[model samples]
Target chain A: MVKTNKQKAGNIITALLLIILGAFMFLPIYLTIVMSLKPQEELFIFPPKLYTLRPTLDNFSSMFDILDNNRVPFSRYLFNSIAVTFTVTFSQCVFVSMGAFVLAKCRFPFSKLINSVIVTSLLYQSNVIYIMQYAVMSKMGIIDNPLALILPSIASPMGLFLMKQSISQMPDSIIESAKIDGAGLFRICWQIVIPNQKPALMTLIIFAFQASWNMQGGSLVFQEQYKTLPTVITQISTTGIARAGETMAASVFMLIPPVIVFMLTQSQVIDTMAHSGIKR
Target chain B: MDKLKKLWCDVRKNRDCYLMLAPFMILFVIFTIVPVIMSLPVGFTNFNMAQPPEFVGFDNYINLFLSDKVFTKAIRVTIIFAVITGPVSYMICFLLAWLIDGLPKKLRSIFTLIFYIPSMANVYTVWKIIFSGDMNGWLNSTLIEWGFIQSPVQWLTDSRYVLGVTITVQLWLSLGAGFLALSAGFRNIDRNLYEVAYIEGMDSKLQELVYIVIPSMKPQMLFAGVMQIVSSFTAGTVAQELVGFPSTDYKAHTIMTHAYDYGWVRWEMGYASAICTVLFIAMYVCNKVISRLFKE
Candidate 1:
């Protein structure tokens, strides 16, 4: 395990490169935190500052103040965000898991067509269909409702694709044994197969939570009370340059929960992402 | 009648699978499938929200390729964006993931989080502070201080810098899920394979990568390629977020932005659907081609 001096130098070079690249990646997210804490005087400095000589929490208080002063209280926005986020994430895990199990194991008519459709859907940008989607959402009577933010996100192709890739990696023997034991399809999907796919489930949970946490019913759901925190935060952000500090504070506010969720489950997510691709 | 009976029996035999799939399928159809399918028919029509969709045949698409100046400019900007950022960011993701893999676990996780946070945190808008035109903006002031420019560059507003600035920001957010997949792909490789390859006569790390790592990580690479291609082709949000929509002179206009400009801003749903359809087809074809290349 002893490294030669030449080998040590190469290793040092590699470490140096990683640090430089890692810093580039980390800069904006770090600046979000750093800039949020800057005092008002620092905001207008000629050649704006990257670091604050005088740090303060006044920006956050003002952000909170703005939230407090809104026609919709901050708590209502927060509540909508939390309720929608939790419902979408939980339901996605359940529904995508169920569908992914059949997609992985069962050979029904049109299964191949369904699988191809789902794969192509993964590559689709939801923006492409937004105009039509608004119409569809209205037709479903979910427009201007909390369901606008929650329902469509509950079963993404990405979630189904992730779970299907993981589930198919499970041996058929295990499912076969469960089937022979007279376990119903639902039991096998939920009780038996799913428990063993923690990494994949965690991956779905992280993505779903991240997407839902940041979901804004922007133009889709017109009601103020039903909109998520991000929609409200963007409204706060429009106060212009004099209020940039509060905007930064609001950005930090919206970012915190997802970052926390990501950190908590990242190991599982990292493990699962590696294995999420085609069977080939 | 015999074939119908056999099909019925088969359907009954696997009804549990149907039952398992129906809930997700219903939601998926309502939310994802139906909308996308509906857009295809809309692409051929002249429909606004106010009126009935009049069948327009190929007029919308004909206008896009033959008449729309902004659409052509959008295609140009998008291709420039895809060509530069797509491969460059893919290599950076791989290289960063490879180096981070070399670090200890604690540092590894921290580095991953650091690189991964921007995409998650909606950091595109945060870049506005840096690209802001005033002397108070970070990039502007820094360039002034360094004597690179006499005046604060309108980084976001200027036509000169919009594409570059947007490309830079898109690259920042590009690590995303694909990077994580590659990093974990590195971890899952059996270390013993490396030792065996080394002892069997591999001397350089590059050799080890070609011989040992890549052969074991095909699936992850394919996934990363598909993700990188999709993100690059669909990279309108970063530009629209960083620069204003219908960016100055349409310099930063992209297919996605063009679609957004028409669909949302003007409510010209018909033409917008055509633009969206074109972009989606381009993305899907690019994905299929990249996946094919990755397989090879």
Candidate 2:
């Protein structure tokens, strides 16, 4: 009877601890949502309304109206973001997979040198070369183009590394068997390796999608059209202080694409994490 | 003759694979590889976009390290921001992961989604509203209502608080990625280890964390640390916007902002590249130290 009581006490303590930690983890989000929905006048009410306030969509409406008058149409920014993100994501996957395949399966001269260069590029971020890149882009006259953003990101080191690691895990006997059957390298990759790497591929897709979507600095430097959602939203916040509600609304809108992508890809991403023993 | 023929056959057989790989290789050379190589030359030249290049040798580097007060201040600020935010954020993520690790799987997923939602949502926009300088701003309104302060504090404008505010936003956004990564790490640990500890009378929370959790999560922690360091060095955008350009008397300025200011705004490409080179060296050294410390 005494042991049972002790066990019950331990369980209660655990429950309480979890609740407190969870609340702390979630407080910032809860605060942001509440702030977003609160009426502008009552937003600063004393003791602050934790609950018990009428919500309004005035913020959302005002944001759209403001976007209508801007020189850079907000919708265009969204389109540009979608275009850049999708292009980078899809391109990175194809290239990384192919490169990984080459490095994994093929015996080629200078492979070690090429792999080292790729790793070096991966470890050193673009911030290291932003100034040089700016000069090059200026000289090339492509400073404000979408290609500037998409092209640089196509050879992602992380994607290549992950894909190589995944591909290396495939059973070599299968490839040997395929070779015996007179199937060429390309046929083996398409028919066997690619099909087997579905989980890793999905993980790469989600990762690439998220990274490209949330990219801030590249978009900042690459486009003058306010042609990306992050750039547009950043501009709004920086320039439109008086229209606080509109800024929040715009931010809310900017967040939807990434959130949807995350939700859609969460399971696959988690599965990849499990298989590879890689943390985020 | 036989060796040459074998090589020929190999090339012919792999031609299709090479074709498949061509686009990436071409783009990589043009974009990533070329820029990295070209960055070194820009550090010695005085060409703005409007003018012809004039080689200036080590003058840019000399001026940055010697005469530029703002550059020095930015380096200091970047270090401060990185030190303050990186560990605190890592701890928050670990805590969240530990808290949610034991919950029912369905509930855990829901909670993960909820916590991650804010990070996915328009971060800059939400932060703009929350940290608005006006009394109408969310933070200001809350503080006033709570009677914590008689008047609204200029959270973003004041040099004292600007870095703090930036760090706060960083902590919030970083929670999801790091937390998710660590949680995945936590889930993969051998459960039998924990069970064994429980049987061996290691019942204290600290004991479990030290012996089981931390040891198992070494790799994840190292990765998170490296990522946080790199990001802290790179992440000056939100702070620049919130704190105002030149960083409120250069108090919140970071190495990234200094490079941007020189390269883009002032059109001093040479100086900017020199500054970037220094920052790169710093990051490289820091990463080396971290790797050595975490080496198995």
Candidate 3:
């Protein structure tokens, strides 16, 4: 690709603009890290210095110190977060892929109906269903249980939709060939379908992980033992003025898993989507 | 009888699919479908947590519209938010995604991460501290130091500034999945078309975007549009997180926050469900209108 001088200048300007834009987008996160590193005394200082003159890990230590005193230790919350998020993401990716496989590859009665139901559910806000969800959870005897969080998230409409969209794009002959080879439905899904739908699966994993990771145990799993890191962070955040650094540290800690998951899987996610035929 | 026979035959033929779908469907029906349907009936009743619900048919809806002043304010605030943030974020997402698409892959991914971190990290609490009401808060301190204000302005607390501040933060976090979707859209555009268009002397970038990029990526554009509308309409968390649950004097009260207040805080589940149903209908209608725009 050859570029004229004007085009080169335009590219440089765009690059500079993007870098500045990136910094602006990231300023809050930068402040969070810097704030978490500041000493408690420095945290409350006037004009709220963006960068600390004297950095310390006291906030991190203090957050752990406080957690050490609780019946459910900090690691328990981390474990809860990890367990819930991983289970939800893994199960969701599997179930949605299965559902997507069925919808995409197999013709069945009510398949279109089921797909519409799922898409319609997406259009409606979840807040509308809060009371009933509570009632349902109570009836299911899962209130204050981690299952309350895990169950609802595992069959997310978005996950199902993404998988279905991706799966529908796959050539039908792959599944037909497997079927002719006397492959069972489950065998075909495991070997042929899931392997090909990696991009959508990755997308589902990211979304599901994020939703579970950020589950504020407000009504469903608010019990101390069942609560995830974000629940604890929200509780601490209300008292944010007094313990700003601790809250910031907790927020950053709570955020690490999703960011890590995203960084690791994002390239595969993009690459697969590139090949998934955007249009027929 | 005929339809049932046909359905049975179809079910038998696709029994394996039914088996595959059962796990997700059972959970989905129990959690998503049942709860949403239950809300429809529950919205007609007075169901405080203490007592069994008493059916009161449309009273909650009427009261919400005619009697609740704050509900009216919430609707206005929500519209103001959706009208501004929805389109702005959609356009910004497209523009940034387009620009990032032009970059090298390594740089593109890094840029994507930077733009995406706020929403991914759930960093609203960090913003809460930055916009803290105290004089020592970052925004307040910076403004005072610059002599922009004689006194510290309460970014979160003061009613006048609350809406503006919330909107700003919402816009910050808005470049999320929709941005990624659009970026993927740009990445997936066929390079052959671009080469062909260039060979034909269709050299202007903006023209290329209009003729080649958007038209080719209609599905992605529609997907991103739906995402933006859903997100914008349901944007209660930023206000609830940054500003208090019910911000000072209801300045930043959005319908979702109102639903949250009634659903959780007051435990007036029926009334809250009514509020939510209204929001659902509004979103559904908007979605329909938006979907119409994309129809061939």
Per-residue lDDT, model 3, residue A47, is 71
- Taken over the whole model, the C-alpha lDDT of each candidate is 0.81, 0.70, 0.82
Judged by whole-model lDDT over C-alpha atoms, candidate 3 comes out at: 0.82
lDDT of 2 by residue, A1-280 (tens): 1356656776688678767756755665566556556667765565456653788888777766766567767678677788899999988987888888877777665466776677556556544366556656667777777666777777876667556655664558778888899987778877777666664566467668877887774433544464666665565554453455566566566666766776665554333323532222
| C-alpha RMSD over true interface residues, model 3 | 2.6
- Order of candidates by DockQ, top first? 3, 1, 2
- Summarize candidate 1's per-residue lDDT along A22-133 as a digit string, tens digits: 7887888778888789988787777666788989999999888888797788899899899999999999999999999999998988799999899798766745477668
Docking tier of model 2: it is acceptable
**Which candidate has the top score in lDDT?**
3
DockQ of 1: 0.49
TM-score of the A-chain for all models:
0.87, 0.77, 0.87
Interface Cα RMSD in Å, per prediction:
3.3, 4.7, 2.6
Q: Tens digits of per-residue lDDT for model 2 on B1-296? A: 99889878876766766776677778777777878997677778896767877998889889988999888888888888878777788787787677777767677766767666655665565566567777767788888877888888888888788888888777666665456556656665656677788889886667899998887677566555666666777768867766778767777788888888887788887777788788877877877787678665
DockQ (C-alpha based) per candidate is: 0.49, 0.32, 0.56
Q: Lowest summed-lDDT stretch of 10 residues in model 1 chain B?
A: B184-193
Put down candidate 3 lDDT per residue, A92-204, tens digits, no spaces.
Answer: 88888888889877877899899878877987785647667888889989998889889888988877876675566566887787889999999999887777556456656
Could you give the CAPRI-style class of model 3? medium
* Deviation in Å, model 2, residue B209 alpha carbon: 7.1
